[model samples]
Target: MTPETGRQLRFAVLDMQVIDPPTGGSRQRLLGLFGQLGSATAYVGTWDWRGQSERKQMLTATLQEHLVPLTPAHFDAVEREAAHINGGTVIDVTFHRLAALSPGYVAAARAAAEVADVVIFSHPWCWPLVAPVMRPDQLLVYDAHNVEGLLRLGLLDDGARGTALARDVVRLELELCRAADLILACSAEDVDGFIRLYGIDGTKIRIVPNGAFAAALSPAAAKEREEVRGRLGLDASPLAFFIGSDYGPNGDAARFIADRLAPALPDTRFVIAGAVGQSLAGRALAANVRVTGAIEESAKADWLRAADIAVNPMFAGSGTNVKMLDYFAAGLPVVTTPTGARGLGGAAGAMRIADAPSFGEAVRSLVADAPLRLDMAAAARRAVERQFGWDRISPATGRLLASRAARRGPAPFFSVVVPTYCRPAHLDRLVAHLEQQRCRDFEVLVVDQSPEAWCGAAWKHGFPLRYVRTDTRSAVIARNLGADLAAGAVIAFTDDDCEPHPGWLEAARPAFDEPGVVGLEGLILSDKVGDPEWRSVTNDGFEGIGFMTANLFVQANAFHRLGGFDGDFEEPHFREDTDLGWRLQAIGKVNFSREAWVFHPPHRRTEERESLQARSRFFEKDALLLRKHPGRYPALFRAEAQWTHNPYFREHLLRGAARYGVTVPDELLDLIQ
Candidate 1:
C-alpha cells in the first residue's frame, strides 16, 4: 500500500539527549529534522543540567524548544562524591530508565503531546520516557537513526561496557519498535534491520535518509582558503581531510586516516578534524598527518574549502554517515568504504566507494587525477543539492504524521518487598538478580532489620529502591512496613537471600491482572549450600500447598484490608507468610503462578543458627500460630501433631535435643508439655 503523503501535520519531537550543545551525531540529525518541519516543537529531556549553559551555546533560537526538566531523587554533590569513593557505582541503570523514575518528565511529555499531531522519539531511548503516558490521539513515531541494538554490538571492543548495557539496549529497541505507530528509518538497510531483527511490520516504516545538514560556508575564495591553511602551518601539499565526532566508528575512521591512509602516502598531507582527533591521544601519527582535536564551524568550512580530497574509512556504525553528507555538501571529491557508504551508496556515481583493503587505492586515484577530482566534486555537490538534501527529506516524512498503529501496552508496576536482616552480601546478590529482570516497572523496598543500619543501599540497584532501617527485627513487621509504603497496585514479597528469576515479575503480572486474584504465590526452588542450613523449600509443586511468601504477590487493597501479615508472628519469622496467605485466601482468591519463581538458597550468610534455644523459639512461634488458627493450622502439619501446638512443638524440640544427646532443660520443660 502507498504511504499517505502530503497531509500536513504538526510534530512534537521528543529527545532525551541534551540537544542545546549537541555532542553526538543523533542530536545533529534531530536538529536538522526539527529546523524545517512545519509547526514543530522539540521537547528535549534534560535530567542533569548543572553546567550546560557554560558548556556551549545553543541553536534552538530559530525554532520552538521546551526543556522538560527531571532531576533525580537525591543525586546530589555528596552522592556523586560517594559514588567515586565506592570504587564503582552501586546502580547501573540506563538514562532512559532513570528518566522513567521521574514522574515530572512523564507528565511533561503527556501535556506537551496534547498540542501536537505526532510525537517523534528521536531515538529508542526516548520511547520509554514518553510511551507510558502517550495520549491515544497522538501518533508515536520512532525515528530510527540506527537499529541501536545492532549498532551497540558493533561499537567498541565487543564487551567494553560488559554484556548488561548491550542487552538492555537491545531489549529497549525491541520494545520501542513494537510500541511505535510509525518508524522513520534513516536508510533502507535500517528498515530491513527492524523487520529482520525484531520482525515488526515493514509497511509502517518509511525511509527519510540523512541529508546535508552542515551550515553554509563563508570565504570559499582561494586567498581565504590559503590563508586558513597557512594559519595551521600546513605547506602547499595537497590536503586530504576527514571530519567526525568522538564516537567509536568515527575514532576508527580517524585512526584509519592517521595510521593506514597517511603512512602509505607521505607526500599527500592529511588532516584529521573534530572531536575524533581526541582518540589519537598519546599515539604518534604519520609525519604527513595533522590532528586538529576539535574545531568551530567556520574553521571546519575553511578546511573544506582548502582540502584537495575527503576520505571515510569507517568499518562499524549504524545509520547513514552525516559526515559523508557534510563532505558531499562541501563539494569535495570523496573516497569511502562500502560500510561508510551504507545508505549513501546512491551517490557512488558522484563519489568513490571501496572496501577496507582497497580504500588506499581509491583515495590515491582521486588524489592523483586532478581533472577527475574536479568532476567528482561537481557531481557530489549536485547529488546533495538534488537527491540527498533536506528539502527532499521533508516531504517524504509527511506520511509519518498521517499514519497510526496500535500502541504497545504499558508494563504494570509492582512494589517488590524484601524483608532483609543482615547478610549485606545476600542483599547485593539479590540486587544483581533483580536488575537482570527484563521488566523495569517495579521498585524494590529493602526493609533492613540489621542491628547496624546498612548506611542505606537506596538508589543502588537498577530498579528504584527504598532502604528502611528498623529497631525491631521481625519479618512480619518488615512485610507490614513495605506494604504500608508500597505505591504499586501489587505488593510482591521475596526474601533478601533469594535470587528471583529475570522473568519473575513478567510472568506474575498477568495472574494479578485477573479478576478476584487478590493474592498469589510462585514456585520456590531451594538451593542447598554445603551443609543444610534450613528447610530446603523446594515445594513439591502441590496445588494449594506452596503459598510461602518466599515468592508471593498480594493485591495492595486486599493486603491492607487483612492488616498485613500478623505482627504477633514475630522473631523466628515462621508462619507469618502462611498466616497471611491463609487469611487472604479466606477473603479472596490466592493463586499460584508456576513460572513466577525464585531460587531459595539456604540462609548461608545469615546467623540463623540451629540450637535448642533456636528450636525453643521456633516452638513458641508454632504455639502462637496454633492459637491464631486452631482448626486450619493443625491441618497443615501431621494429623496427630496438628491437634495442638504441644505435641507438634514438643516433638521438634525433643528431636533437636536428641541431636546433642540432651533432654529439654528443667526450666523450659513445663512450657513444652
Candidate 2:
C-alpha cells in the first residue's frame, strides 16, 4: 500500500516527562515531531509537581497526553537498585529506575503501542518497559538524545563505579538498539558513536537534529517578546543571558559563566535562567550576574529578547544544543564554544565560536558593537530557518512515518536458512555474524549437507540455532528441506560464505509488508572479485529483480507455491537461485533493498578449483533455465544489460568500496563503458 492509500498514522511517544512545557531538548524534539504527525499521543511519566500541572493542560488539537504518576517510592526503589549496582555509590539512577519502578508508565505505554502503527521511545531506559507491550507489527523507533552510557561515564567521579555503570548502560543501550527497528539519533556524531562503540549497522540509524519550532520566531511572537521585556523591567544596559535545565553539562556551563565570563564582562549584566539558575544562585557572582531561579515557560521568550547576546560556554555535552537553537529563534547573537556548537555544523558559522579564555571576550565584543550583534542576529535567525528549525527537521520525521505507515499487515518473523556443504569454517563465521544481527526475532536454520555434522560448534553462539543434516549434497534440496521445517512467515536465504550485515534482517523485514512483494534481493558486496566488471555486476545486480540466494528473502507461502528450488539442478549447484527468482516473479512482485547488505568473499582455497570448473557448467544450467521458462531469458538478459549501465550501479560500487575501507581505481569506471 502506498502512503496516500493508507489512513493517517497514529503516532505514540513514550517519554519520561510531559511535553506540554518540554523540559529539555529531548522533550522539545518529541513535541515538535508529534505536532507534525497530527494524530499523536504521548504516554509520559510525571514524577513531580511541575509535570503534574503540565499533564493537566496537555490536551491539544494535535496531541493527546497520558500521564503516569511516578511516586516517591519509585525514586527510592531506583536509588536502591542503582546503589546495589554501583556498590553503594549514589549515581544518576533516574534511567535505571524507570523500567523497574514505573509500572503505570509501562502499562500506559503498552496501551498506546497496541493501537498506534508507530511507537517512539524517548530513551533506551523506556525500551525494556515498553517493548513487551508493543505488538510485533508496530514500528519501534528509539529517539536517542545522546549516547547515555558515555554521557553518564563522563559525569562520574568514582572510576570503578563509573566503569561498572558504564558497562551496564552500554549493554542496555545495545539491547535497545537491537530491539528498535529504526534509531533516530540527535546528531551524526551519535550515529557514528553507535556504530563505533557497539558495531551497529549505519543503515538502521538516522539523524533527526534537535531544533526549535519556526513558530517561535513567527511575527506574532515579536509582540510577546516586547511585552516580556517590559514586564521583566530590563533597561538599555546590554544584557547577556544563558538558559538550561539541570543537567551536568548545564551546571558546568553555568559555573563557567559565573566564575570566568561574568568576572571578565563586569560592565554587562548576565542573566542565568531555568533549573540551573538555582544552583548558580549560591555561587559568588560579580554584582552584574543575576540568577532568575527557574523561569516559567511563558517568560522564556521575554528573557531571550531581553538579552543582547546569548552565551553557551559548554565544554562537555554529547548531542546538539537546543538552547543554542532557542537563542537563534529569539534572534539573539550567540557566543558558544565549538563543543557547545557541536551538531550545528554549517549553522555554527552564524555564531561566534570561542574557547574558554576567549569566550568572555567574544561575548563582550558582541555586546560592545551593536552593528556586529545585529549582523550576527540576522545570520543566526537565517541559520535557524535554514537548518535548525522544526519546519526543516519535522518533514523528515513525517516522511519516515508515512513510509512505515504504507506497509500493510503485521511484520513477518524471519527464518534465516543457510545451506552449507562441507565448509564448516564458513558456517562458523556465518553463525558468528548472525549472532550480531540487530533484529532478534529471527531464528537460524543451518542446513548442513556435509558428510560429518561439523556445524554443531555453532550451537554455542546462541540465538535459536537449528542444525539439520541432509544426506543430499545439494544446496537446493537443503534449502527446501530447511523451509519445510521452518516455522516463520518469511524464509531468508544466504550461503555459508556470505557474511550478513548487522542490520540485514531489520532492513529486509519491511519489504514483505507489501502483500504483493513475494521476494526481496539484498545487495551482495564482494571485495574478492578481482575484475572491476564483475564488481560492477555485483552492484548492478542489487537493482535487478533477478535474485541471488547469497542474500534473499521470500514469503513462506510464496516459496511453497513455487514448489521450492528445482531438485534437477542439484548436481551442478548453479542457476537454482536464478530459476527461483523467475518462478517468484511469475507469481508476484519482487523488491530490492541496498541497505540489507552481505559480504561474499571469493571462493576459498579448496573451492577455487571447483568454482573454476563450475563456470564451464553455467551454459548447461543457463540452457536448462531458458528451456524451462521459454522466451523469458532474452528479456532477462536485456534487463541485465540495462542494470550494467545503471548510474546507481556505479554509485553503489563506489559506496560499497568506501564502506569496506577499500579504494577502487578511477580507471575501473573507464572499463565499465
Candidate 3:
C-alpha cells in the first residue's frame, strides 16, 4: 500500500479547481476514489487565485487544515495573492487564469509523477493547455469529463474551424489514450464515445461514475425552511424548489415554471434558487413565484427538505443530473423534463416526467394529490438508497477497477458454459474467480437444475452472466442449454467443480486462432479420483472419464454446427462428450491442449454423485443414443446379444444400427456370426 511499492498508480488531475471545486458530482467521485486508493498521490493543479471571498472562506480553511503555516517569502507573497482569488467563484476569473497559467500546474503534476509509477491528466476542458507538457509513462490515464468547449465554439455547429478543432481535440485525446496505460470516464456513454472517437480499444477504458456529496445527504434543519417560508410570507403554501440559475437552461426552467405553471396552481409556491443572472432573476415574477436568489450554502439542504416537489426543466445537458440525484437523496419527489433526467437510468420510476407543454398540468396534478406525491417521494428515496448512493456505487466501482479494468489485447472474447445441479458453493467460487480475471471479455452461462436455491449468489455477482432453470438432468443436455444463450465469438467450457488456472485463457486462446480447429480438449487435473470399483459400478460411469466441458473452448459458430449435444444420449451419465468429440472430429479437428488445465475439486460420495433422474428414464435415454449414432460405435451395439444377454438392448441396437448408416466392424462381426 506504500506509494513507492508494487504497481503505484499516480493520479495527476491538473487544472482541476480546488476552490468551490465545482462541488459537482465529478468532484464527489474523485474524492471517493481518493478514499478508496488512499495510497495514490493526488496532484491538484489550480489557477493562481481562486477568488477573494471563497479563498478566505473555503480555500484558506482547507489549506490551513492540511498545510502548516510558515513565514513569508518571495514565492509566499505570490501564493498569498493567488490563494486569495483562486477558488469556486462564479466569475470566469479563476478558470481563465487556470487556463492561462497551466505551465506551473504541469510542472507541479509532472514533478509528482516522476516519483510515482502512473500519471493521469484529466479534466479535458482544463488540461488541453497542459497536454503538450505531460510525460509519457506505462500508466497514464486521461479523464474526459465532457466535450463541451467544442459545442460552444460554433465549430461543432457546422463544418467550420470549431468542427476541425473538435475533430483535433478528439484526435489528440485518442493519441493521449494510446500513450497511456489506462483511461477513465465518468459514464459508459463517455467511454463508448471515446472508443468511437479516438479508435482506442474498448478494453482500455474504465467507467467510474460521479458520486453524490455529503451536503446532499445530511438532513436539513426543519426550522431553517420555516424561516425562509416565513420571510416570503408563503408559510401556508406547499414549497417546490429549483437549483441552478446562471446557466441558460436554468433560466429557461425558471421562466417555464413561473409563467406557465404558477398561475395554474396558486396553492403551490415555486422557489427559484441558486445564483441567477440579474436580468433573468427580475423577469415577470408572479405572487406565488419567489426568487430566493442563491440561498446561503448552509440553507440549501433545508430548502430541499422543505419542498414537496422539486422541478428540473432542463432543455440541454449531458452526464448524470447531480441535482436530481441530490433531490432523490433528500427523499423528495421530482417533476423533471426528459433532458433533466438523462443518464441516471433509474429516474423514470423515481420521478414525474413532463415536457414544456404538459409541465404545468404535471406540477398541478402532484400538488392536488397528496398520496401520489408521497408515493413518488418514497420511490425516489428507495432509488437513491438502493442504486444511486455513494456507498453502493463505491463497491461496484472498486470491483471493476481493481478486478477488470486496464486489460487489452488479441485476447479471445470467449463465453464460458458452466452447468450446475445443487452446487451452490462451486457456483459462487466460479463467478468470484471470473470477476477477478485480468482478462474479462467473456460471458458466463450457468445452467441450474437446483430448484431449491435458484442460483442465489451466481446471479448476484454483477458480471456478464446468465442463468437457466431445468428439471431433467443430463450433463450434455445442460451444456447444450447453456450454449443456446451464449453471446461471445468463442465458447470456453468448464465444469462447476473445476478451478481454471489464471492464465488458462492466455495458454488456450491460440487454439481458436489455429486454422480448421473445431473442438479443443482441456485437461482435468484432479488430485483425487473416485474409487475405481465405484467408477466401474455406476452404469455408464464416465464421470471419471475426466474430460470436462468445464475447461474446453470452441468456436461458437462451430459448436452450433455440431447441432449441440446429442440429447438422445441419456445415461444419466456417459458417452455424450466422446460421441460429441468424434462427430466434431468427423467434420474438423479436435486437438488436445495440455497447456489448458483446470483443477477438478476432489470427488464427493456416491449419494452425492447420483443425478436425480429416475433409473427407468435413464435406461430409456441410454437406449435412444445407442440407437441414433451406432455408426460411431458399431461393435458395442451389434454384438451385445452374443457376449452379454441383454436381449432388449441387443434387439434395439441391431435394428437401430441398420436403421442408421453405421456398419459393424468386419473383425468383430465374424466372431459374433
Candidate 4:
C-alpha cells in the first residue's frame, strides 16, 4: 500500500509493441523495466499489434496474466488523401492513424483505470486513448524512449510538409507531458531534450538508460568462429560487422558505408547485417562488402563472433544506442559516430567515437593494433557484465516506479465472509482476530447457517458488521450467497473453525491487486490435537498457497464472473472451493501467500460419525473432484489416492470401518493401503 493515500500499487499497462521476442532496443527497454515489475505488483495491459493474438500476456510471472484485446488500425487510402491535402508526410500520417484506439480498448482501459492506482503509457503515440479515461487522482506515467517529435522530422526529407507534420507531433507530445505525473526518459540527453524542446518539468523525469541481456552473450569459441567465418565465405582479414533494423537512420548509415567507407578499406571485409542491408541490395558496391538481409538472432550472434570489429555509422537519432550494448556484451570493440554512442558515458571506452570522414582510419588503426582491440574488448565486456545487463539495470526503474506510485490512490477494501455452523466459540475466536487487524478498511459479513443464529444475539464487533441468517446448509451456497450480498470489492472467506492471523487481511490486499490475479490462497496451518483421528492440515501443497475455504480471498469481479462456486458440488463433493479454484486458473492467476495464515483445529466427532466418514460411499467425493478437474487433480492432490490425509489418519479410517462392521469396497480399500 501507498505511504500517502495507502493504496495498493496496481497498474494498468499500455503498450504498442510485443515484447516477448523483443526484436529491437525500444522493446527490450520496456520488457526490462515493466516486465520485471510484474514480480512484485499487479499489472495488466493491451497491445493492438496485428497477428499478436499468440501473446495473451507479457512474458513473465504476473498475476497469472490477462490482457484486454485492443483493435489494430492501419493507415488506409482515405488517411493518406487527408495527409496529402493537409501537407503532412506519410510517416506522420501513419503514426497519427495508429495512435487512435478503438472503442473496445477505450472501454476496457476506462474500467481498468477506475480500479488501478497507476496508468503507464509505454510511448506517447498511443497515449491519446488513456488521456480521456484517466481519473483526476490517478498517477500517469509516460515512458519516453526518444524525443519523438524531433525524431520523426529526421525520418522525412527537409521541407515544409515534414516540418508541418513535426509540428503536430510536438503538440501531441506537449499534451502527453501535461497529462503525465511522471516521465521516464531514456538518458540525460533525452531529459534535456524533453525540457528544452517541450519545456517539461525536470523534477518529474528519471534517467533510465536502455539495457541488454548481457549474460546471454559471450565471446565466440575458436572452432565455432572459424566455422561461421567459413560459412559466410569471408576472408581472414579484419571483418567489420554492422547490424541494424530497417529504420531510416540505419538505411542512411548503411548507404554511407557502401558508398564511402568500404571502398577506402579494399583489403578489409565489411559485412552489413539485418534489415538495413535491404536498402543496399540493388546498389553497386565494393567487392569487399557483403549484405545479409535480416538474419535470425543466432545468425547475428554468429556474425558477432566471426567479425573482428563492431561498427555503427549512425549520425542521427534520439534515445541511447541499444545495439551498441550488444557489441559490448559480445566482447567486440565498437567504432561509431558520436550519435551511435549516445546514452552510455562513452560506453566506458567500449566505443571509439569517430566521424564519417575518418571512419576508415579508425578501423585501420584497430586492425593494425591487436592489443588495442583486446583492451577495448575487455572494457566493453566489463561495461556490459558489471553495469549494463538487463538484470543489473532494471531494478532502479522498478524502485523508482514503486516509490513514486506509492503516493497515490485509496486504501483497499475487503468484505470478510465468515460461514458458521453451530460453533459459537470458533466464531468468537475468529471475530477476535479480525477486530485486532492492522488494516481497518474492511467489513465483516457473518453468514450464519446454524439454527436460530448460534453465533449468539449478543455477538458484537467494533467495525461495521452484517449478520445474515441463511437456511442453506451447503458451504457452496453459503459462500455464493455471501458473495451476492458482498459490498466490498474483494470477498475474503474464512471458516468459523479457523483462526486467521492479525495481518491476514492486510497481507491479502496486495496480492488481489496484482496484475491478472483473481484468487489468493493463504497458508492454512494445522492447529489440531488428534492427528490420527481427525486431520485439518491444509498448508501442505497448493504450490505454497492453499485454496481451502478456511483461508481464501477472491476479487469480487472474478468471483461474480465464475458465479461464486458451483452450488452443485456442495452435496456429495465437499470440494466446491477446490473446483472453483481450479476453474479460476483458466481465467487469471491464483496466487498463494504464506503470510496470510489460518489455524484450523480438529473437530471432535462421535464414533458413528467417524464410521460414516470411513464408508465406501463417503469416498465418492474424491472421484467427483477428480472428474470435475481431471487435469489439475493430480497436482492438487498429488498421485496418492488419499491426498492430504496422513498414514495414521488412513489407518484410523480403516480401523473405524472394521469397528462398525462395515466392509470397504475394493476401490475404496486401495485408498487406505
The candidate scoring highest on TM-score is 2
Question: Considering every candidate listed, which one attains the maximal lDDT?
Answer: 2
Candidate 2 Cα lDDT to native: 0.69
Write the residue-wise lDDT of candidate 2 on 1-673 in tens digits. Answer: 2355456677777766667667677678767766665555555555443234324335456567667776556666666756654644232334544445556656776777788878887777667666667778778888888887677677663667556666777777888888887777766567667777877755456566788876765322556656766788866677888999877789899899888877887888888898887667656788888888787765777787677888899988787889888888878878888788766643532577778987877787778878767666776776667556776566546655555555454443998999888888888788889989999888777888788988365547647676777555667757866775555678899989888999999999888888799889889887645543233125444365457888888887667544467543444456678888888887688888889999887544345443433344343344445545655654554555533534444444443333222334444446444
Error in Å for residue 349 of model 1 = 2.4
List model 4 lDDT by residue over 1-673, tens digit each.
4677654567666654546566777667766666665333333344433444423543665431335444544425325544653633353334434534455545655666667777777666656766676787777888888888788766643576556666777787888887797777766557767877887755556556677787677877779889988997767888998988878789888998888888888888888888888888779999988898888888888889888889889988998878888888889988888688766642434666678888878888777778778877887877676546777566545545665665334423788888777878888888888888887998777888788676343566776676767555656656655664555678888888788888888888888657999888888888454355554456555443226888888877566544466533443325677777877787789988889887877544445544435433434344445544655654544444453544444554444343221344555455456
User: What residue runs in model 3 are displaced by over 4 Å at the alpha carbon?
Assistant: 1-9, 19-35, 48-102, 125-137, 149-183, 187-201, 214-233, 277-279, 394-399, 402-412, 415-423, 426-673
Candidates in descending lDDT order: 2, 4, 1, 3
Question: Given candidate 3, what's the lDDT at residue 109?
Answer: 49
Q: What is the TM-score of each candidate against the true structure?
A: 0.54, 0.57, 0.55, 0.56
Best of the two (2, 3) by TM-score: 2
Off by over 4 Å in 1: 1-8, 21-24, 47-49, 52-62, 69-93, 100-104, 156-161, 218-223, 403-673
- Evaluate model 3: give its lDDT: 0.55
lDDT (C-alpha, whole model) for all candidates: 0.67, 0.69, 0.55, 0.68
In every candidate, how many clashes are there? 0, 0, 16, 4
* TM-score between candidate 1 and the true structure: 0.54
lDDT of the structure predicted as candidate 1: 0.67
Which residue pairs overlap in candidate 1's backbone?
none
User: Where does model 4 exceed 4 Å of error?
Assistant: 4-8, 38-54, 63-101, 108-114, 157-161, 407-673
